[model samples]
Target: MALEIHNITFDCADSRGLATFWAGLLGWNVYYDDDPEVVVAPSYPNPGMGLLFIPVPEGKTAKNRVHLDVAPDEGTRDEAVERAVAAGATVTGDHRKDDGTGWVTLLDPEGNEFCIERGAAERGPRTSTAYRIG
Candidate 1:
């Protein structure tokens, strides 16, 4: 037997709001939205994992041990970061390197940390090649 992941749930103060933010960020659609919970996924009959937001009594007090790292599907890293900021995300740390590498850490509306990395187009082509020697 094998197990498969269904959804990644986030315990939040406002499930609908958090789910809205995530849905907008990921360009996913909200499948369900009730008082205590909200579910967002790519589409009906989606084969991949979805996001579920559940209401919680407590607020986030410390840093998140687990976080999501996002890469743009069409634009540059800077563009994605800017969009996130515009959507109410706060920049917690800027880890981008001068060499155009590294990622930026950001806190979502509820203070959940996530990262933005360079997109495939922004990274361009590899400058060096790897070789194996025995």
Candidate 2:
């Protein structure tokens, strides 16, 4: 038997707001929107590996131990970063190299960390972890 990831859950202060931020960032749609819990995915009928946001009384106090690394499907990394910033994300670090390699780290509206890396069309052969560190 094999197991697959069904959802990546986030404990946040505002479930709907956080889910909306993620849905816009990932070009997904909010499938479920109920108080204290909201879900965002690529689709509704068959939402594969959705992002689930649940309300918590407390706010984030520290850096996230696990974070998401995303890439654009049809744009550059900088463009993606710009979109994220417009969607209520704050840039925490910019790690792009002189040769145009690396990722940008940002915090979501609720302070959850995520990264924007080179898009599929822009990435070449990844030889080492030189671009992984930020």
Clashes of 1: 0
Q: Please provide, for model 2 over 1-134, each residue's C-alpha lDDT reduced to its tens digit, 9 standing for 90 to 100.
A: 66999999999988888999999999899866345688999976888899999888888998899999999999799999999999899999999999988999999998899999999788976667655543
Task: Give the deviation of candidate 2 from the true structure as CA RMSD.
Answer: 4.4
Candidate 2 error regions (>4 Å): 33-35, 125-134
Best by lDDT: 2
lDDT of 1 by residue, 1-134 (tens): 66898988888998888888988988988766345778888887653799889889999988888899999999889899999999989998999999999899999999999999999898887799899875
Candidate 2 residue pairs that clash? none
Worst lDDT 10-window in candidate 2: 125-134
- lDDT (Cα atoms) of all candidates against the true structure: 0.88, 0.91
